[model samples]
Target chain A: MRIVVDLNRCQGYAQCVPLAPEVLKLNGEEALTYNPNPDDAQRLRVLRAAAACPVQAIIVDQLDLKK
Target chain B: MSSPTNGNALKDKGRIVIVGASLTGLRAAEALRKEGFSGHLTIIGDEPHEPYDRPPLSKQVLKGWVPADHTKLPRMLEVHAEWRLGVAATGLDRAKKVVRLADGDEVPFDRVLLATGVRARQWPNPAQAALEGVYTLRTSNDAARLQAALAAGPRRVLIIGAGFIGSEVASVCRELGLQVTVAERASAPLAGALGEVIGAIAAEMQRDAGVDLRIGVSITALEGDASGHVRRARLSDGSTLEVDVVLASLGSIRNIEWLEGAGLAAGFWGVGCDAGCRAFDIHGIVTDHIFVAGDIARSPHVLFEYQFLSMEHWDNAVLGAEVAAHNMVCEEIERRAHLLVPAFWSAQFGVNIKSVGVPSFGDEIVFTQGSRKERRFVAAYGRRGRIVGAVTCNNGKWLEYYGAQIARSGPFPPHPAGFDLPGDMRVVPAEFPARGVPTAAPDVVLTGHDPSERHAEFRPRAR
Candidate 1:
């Protein structure tokens, strides 16, 4: 699965960090870094992280594939 | 082993009814489908609109950056459930396992989820609240009305109670270059959520952003003009201000009235539930069919000394709903506990304030990193030599680090000092107001023991 984060909407809430620590990481105070592609085994964790974002900034490509 | 056909027959068949069609209800509906629950699902809500995002109602929606109607939450999955909008669940008949609606309809269910949530507390005076310009920012309708009022360019906006919602509105008014006066009864802003030490900094932030911050005073009365529009506000300090718009940001009241005679352990605090989100009877006996989540569920946390905590935040609603939904369909062996560490975030005065865990649970605080003078710092809350919570101002990237410490019950005055440590790390009292003191910011409530119960009952199951 591939991940995408809307940098413009990401206000650095960092809610997605702990949920998917292996997939997403925070660089500094407000800068966020994440892996665009993650193993399929991490689908559940990635989906949770995406859903937990307050701003709905995170997007997963798996949903698109299902479409 | 059972054949695949037999397993499929047992997969899903029962009917599930979910109360409260807001964030929690909507998410749980989708999650139930994701959990392979092919049962008949029914979602009931009082609001006419479908599930929509609420955090933006106070920020982006009020600012007109996004319209109120456009805040509808994106459906992550197709939830083929019956939608009963604009009608409220009047009562829950647990004996019959059905939910009574206001429209004289009864929906039977094998399982039920109560996520009624809370509503904003309006002005005490009904007559004043009916005035044209008096507003309370809770629903999308409230935000749309207040946004139009702000767009109309009122001469002055008189905001009562400097809570997070009130403070956010004050910030928006200043950004629009309108005169806004915030009158708070506490000495500092947000003293109810974060202690006075950080609240003092918030008071300065409001003042620095061109808000007429008034502390230690309350709006005694709101006066309306001949046209029945709010025209002036009388303060407790024997002063009056001419204002066109008045917002009563007086916290919220849990939507537990509908569950009054349901025999559930629900009251002024909220519905009492166990760690697994199963509702308890008035006698404190855990029930099997009924469940609760979101802001209305008050379950005890093991990390916080088993005190029932009621958290009203965006994250809590989403997390709690997922937990409730999971337990509603899965077997006992597959069930999980809802032990999510309480967290919340707010954006006001150009500063992003985020907290991990319940800061109100701590008795003392110590600054670990950054500078408070710069309005960028991280403070850790300690209780009995353990880290219970942490709040960061514009330094949310470090939240996960502190949140880990809080989850493990780390020692107070955290070590492994980062490179950006503050010069002085003096431990001081958090200085929270005495319990039962009414404040606008009622973020978290840790209720220990039942306050209303007079007697207890015990029963033993046959071996």
Candidate 2:
């Protein structure tokens, strides 16, 4: 799976940080920081994080290819 | 990714109707498909537009970072269902299995989900409420209008109540360099939610942010010019402010009037439902088909002494919708319970406020981590020798840990600190003022919106 986070649109709601800590996280300044390429094992959680965002700032695509 | 979830996967089955086509409604529609409920799914909403994100209305939308119209909640999962927008469900015929719409259309369903959320509580005085320059934020249109009004640069803005919405609006006013005053009948801002201890700090934060913080006071009356534009407001202290804008942030009123003759267990506290999200009748008997979710759902929480809690947080809406949808199509044994932990977050004045569990249910608070003096800390709220809730300010990392402890119903002021604590980590009494306390001024009714605020007064009569 591929992960894309819109840093410009991220207002640091930090909802994604908890749901997908392995893929998305917050920096020391509390700004959003995340790994664009997460392991395949983190697919479900990463997608869940994308759905959880109220701002819809996170995008997870390319699910059919698996790994 | 998953292309689109096909509700047809489960084959044609019983009809499932979801009311309130907003966040909860849309999510519930998707969940019905995810849970293999292929029945005829119909969604009815009062709003003309699709479901939009409301959390940004006060923060980013007001700050102009995002246009109110652009805050639409993305439909990540395709919901193949009949969409009936711009119409409200006027009544529910539980016995007949029909939902009456405002347009006189009765949508029949094998099961129905009530997600009719709350509306902004208007000013008591109709004349004062109708005056120009007075506003309330509950919908996207409201945010847009308020945004335009703010952009016009009013000389002074008076926020009548210092609740979350009011305080956030004040923050935006200051961000826009507008002179702002915040009035609260409580001793401090957020005192009703966080109790006087944390509320005092919030009051200081507002004052420090250049807000004219007026505690223990209320607007007696709003005086307007001949053009019917509100220009001034009379205060409880016998003072009048030359304010151009007045925000009636008195909180929200649950939208349940339409269900008046419907005979469902609904009132000011919203619709009563079992843990599985099945609606309860007036006699407290759980219905088999009718379901309830979102900010409108009042369900029992085992964490809080089996008391029915109605939470208005964004997370609650999503979680409740999924659970309700799952239980709607499943049998008794396969049903899922909407046992939400009641978490919420808010950002204002450069501070992030996040909480887990029900803080208002606790009797005392302890600063388990960090220091309040430094304006960053974590406090645990305890009740009956158990940690019922925990709140964090700029300390989000530890919230999940605290949430686990709260879920375990750990001892009040859990020992060992678990991590580093301030030198004086003393457990102090959480001073929750009596509900509906008599204010110093008769004109100002300080509504303590604890989510379950009016439930105590509502349940007895509902029974």
Strongest candidate by TM-score: 1
What TM-score do all the candidates reach, one by one?
Answer: 0.85, 0.84
Query: Which portions of model 2 miss their true places by more than 4 Å?
Result: A1-67, B1-11, B416-418, B437-463
- State the lDDT of candidate 1 residue by residue for B1-463, as single tens digits: 5421232322467788999999899889888888898978999999999887787678767776657775666566888999999999999998888999999999998889999999999898999899999999989999999999999999999999988999989988987899999999988889989989999999999999999999999898999989999999999999999999999999999998788678778876889999999999877889987899999999999999999999897777787989988888776788889998988877788787888989999999999989899878999999999999998888877777888999999999877456699988999999887776444432323344776745443221221
lDDT, residue B417, candidate 1: 55
Return the top candidate by lDDT.
1
Q: What pairs collide in candidate 1? A: none
lDDT of each: 0.84, 0.80
lDDT score for residue B285 of model 1: 86
In the order shown, the candidates' DockQ scores are: 0.10, 0.09
Q: What tens-digit string does per-residue lDDT give for candidate 2 at B151-254? A: 99999999989888998899889988999999899888887777888888888889988999999998899999999999999999999899888899998878
Q: CA RMSD for every model?
A: 8.1, 8.4
